[model samples]
Target: MKQTVEPVLQDKFERRFLYLRLSITDVCNFKCNYCLPDGYRPNGTKNSSFLQLDEIQRVVSAFAHCGTNKVRITGGEPSLRKDFTEIIASVAQTQGIEKVATTTNGYRMAEHVAQWRDAGLTHINVSVDSLDANQFNAITGQDRFKQVMSGIDRAFEVGFKQVKVNTVLMKDLNDYSLPQFLDWIKHRPIQLRFIELMQTGEMDDLFARHHVSGVSIRNRLIAQGWLLKSRQANDGPAQVYYHPDYLGEIGLIMPYEKGFCTSCNRLRVSAMGKLHLCLFGEGGLDLRHLLTNDDDQPALIEFIQQQLETKKVSHFLDQGNSGATPHLASIGG
Candidate 1:
């Protein structure tokens, strides 16, 4: 990929867009309540729906040209992609790109952990809601807790230094399991994040039943003697903190409690090639046609820049709506 020092992608809010969350496939292996509560069916087989390797590389190049240094490869479950390691290598090697990461459920990761680490995968964020086998099954609608834990261990063993655990702390569901989560991270250099539940799908009742506030989590951590302080790094929407007692720090992502709209700097590209400015946005600019039908790089940059002007100040989901325009399953969380 040829490198060009394009101007940094800045939105009207003066938020510099240096991070890109690129979804390679929307289809997943497990169904979580926060996402596809009912199970998922791929719109097309691997032969047709998923973005081709070349297509993915071009998107990375384009975003890198627009000053996106960090790229997080997300999916319904990213490891489900057959050439996942290759995708990591491609993005990690792109000119001007600094870091490449993946967010996965960890079911299919054990087999390829070493390969991915060797292929330049910078970080891994595993979505684990519970440590109990039964609760895990109930949450994900899958019997893969052992597999997931094994994959997480493998990632750490393979020397992926920044392996973090993303635990969605629900109220009645997994709220009682915070101790279990803390015990699991003991003496391990794995940071844990309690992601507050957000209204993103057709499940208002679910949120009412299981949504846990970040304040509750903070109090729990303080009771455990964790010295928590607000972090300033705008790496993402995570409200980070530090605890000297633990090997790794703790974080709280309050998408509903604390909105990060003023400093929202990330843009999303769905697997089908649509550029989304907000996670809860309804529509996006189609870049597939530009990639396949045209060869004008400047035109592609201009198109994305123009669309960035229309980004919503904050997500519509935050407003007490039943759901957002695009369901969670369609985009990578």
Candidate 2:
């Protein structure tokens, strides 16, 4: 029951890598066409995989002891996990951990936001691709738009002040709804992030067919009288922009067009406990094995440092090239 500890500075970059996106489960409730293909199904034995909750705690604690300050729980949809609140509480109770967040599809958030907040959850990032119900269904293959909207409202009601709406803008799909989506958050203090679609999983054609850049989206917003002013104190992966007259902030994360590898300070631990240095990386260090081997904190910390040192500065995926990498979902976008 050790409290969260601050992350120790590593020599990979000048900044201390304090943030970790812990994917608790690879299993997702919704079959988003972009995330998973139409005919996709789990290939192996059901019980043969997935990291245990205790294993997660051990790994997270180890990272915290190494000076990690923030932990974000993500999944196919994290809320679908039965012990999600327990996991949140466990991560929050860690001594030096300053923030505990979760990114969910928001399908089941309405029934659990207050419970999560009570469990010491600091923030929530809900993914909503389209404001239109039918379009949403087409994108996610789930007719749960109303449920998600209700969840957003409930998240606000539960005192989660830093609620962010993550929208993956695909060309010709939900790109046109950007302004309307921004309009919905214009008066609220919510953060609306527009993510460029990356070629991953079964969406290679989709990425090729509708590759929309953040600049294009920003220009469109500008043409509509939405003035975007760059924020002075912004950090993290997203390029933040704000309207002087508007209430909320807009974040544009264009991984494809512009590379942020030099200033990138994030590390991703998959649902299975593999440490991925880059989102487009093909390999990772198996942290679950380290946890199960022994409570050897020093060994674990050394392994993490070794992986970080080997981390690539950035990733480049050329659509026209023959040997391009896989999509973002498989790599945990």
Candidate 3:
């Protein structure tokens, strides 16, 4: 039975979504101060398992049918899943999905990155908060900075033209070390991304104490002769900049900035199979039931389109509302 194809996913604000950030697990090994500080805790429930392979495949296929060209496999740490490579392959082989990316802590990258690339992983983003080893340890509660760095080198060796590094800029922390970050990326093909600290439901105190805007960073880049690059149709929200002297690039993700959501082009799906219209929006629509079989693809597509219509034009982050999001790890930040 041929299912009727729906129009591309778009919201009332006239923004078209061409990317999906799909979380494969809520379990993260790192205890980042802003996110899972104490470590990942299971609720000890029988139904706490993440979506299975088949479920992810069916849901991704439905999304592909609705015009999602890129699928970024995210997680508390997506690489933690044993079947992560399989997940990448499935998403890459899905019709209409041109890109298969993943975000990780780089714990296993040094060991398994080649296998990941061979399994159809198109792009990789690693979290590297600080250039100083000790500061990196303090921020992420891990002393594997050397290993993570090695993983990045391996990524390049394995033929990744450019790797992205996500650094959450926070006051009195790595915020002052932008110069060091710049020097490190000057000769490498790394896209050093600086993400603004966001306030979540569980970290009000942390947010108040460490939140730093990306405006200053953007200004600094412009003053330093970094040219703002135009965004592609399937690109994420990061405002990318390139310079003539550097082999690398820089990206700024300022969620609190005015008109930030005006160019939003991605949607999130939790590891437990809930579709989130916005990263900081309210509750998600449960789609796990609809992801069970291939026969459910049509209904799943319909439900997604219907729910997408209710998406808010912008998030309430400016109003201090990180609705239903306890922290970044829960839904794959």
Ranking by TM-score: 3, 1, 2
Superposed by TM-score, candidate 2 places the C-alpha of residue 65 at a distance from the truth, in angstroms, of: 1.3
Candidate 1 structure quality by residue, lDDT tens digits, 220-317: 78887887565443387776666665677687887766555776878888888888888877766788876763265667788888887877677755
Taking every candidate in turn, the Cα RMSD to the unseen true structure, in Å, is 3.0, 3.8, 1.9
Summarize candidate 3's per-residue lDDT along 1-333 as a digit string, tens digits: 999756678887788889999999988889999899999987464334798999999978888888999999998898888888899989989989999999999999999999999988999999999989999999999999999999999999999999999999889977989999999999999999999999999999999999988998899889999999999999999999999999999999999899998898999998989899988988778998887678998788888888878988889999999998888888887
Candidate scoring better on TM-score of 2 and 3: 3
Top candidate by lDDT: 3
What would the per-residue lDDT of candidate 2 be over residues 1-333, giving only the tens digit for each residue?
999664464645554577888887766767776677562355363623667777778878888887787888887667767898999999999877888988888988899899999999997888999999999999888899999999999988888776798998887888888668777887988889888777664566877888787778878767766654553311457777777767887888877665556667667887767888777776667877688743666787888887777765567554343122243334356
Pairs with steric clashes in candidate 3:
none
Q: TM-scores of all models? A: 0.92, 0.89, 0.97
Candidates ranked by lDDT = 3, 1, 2
* Superposition error at 39 for model 1 (Å): 0.8
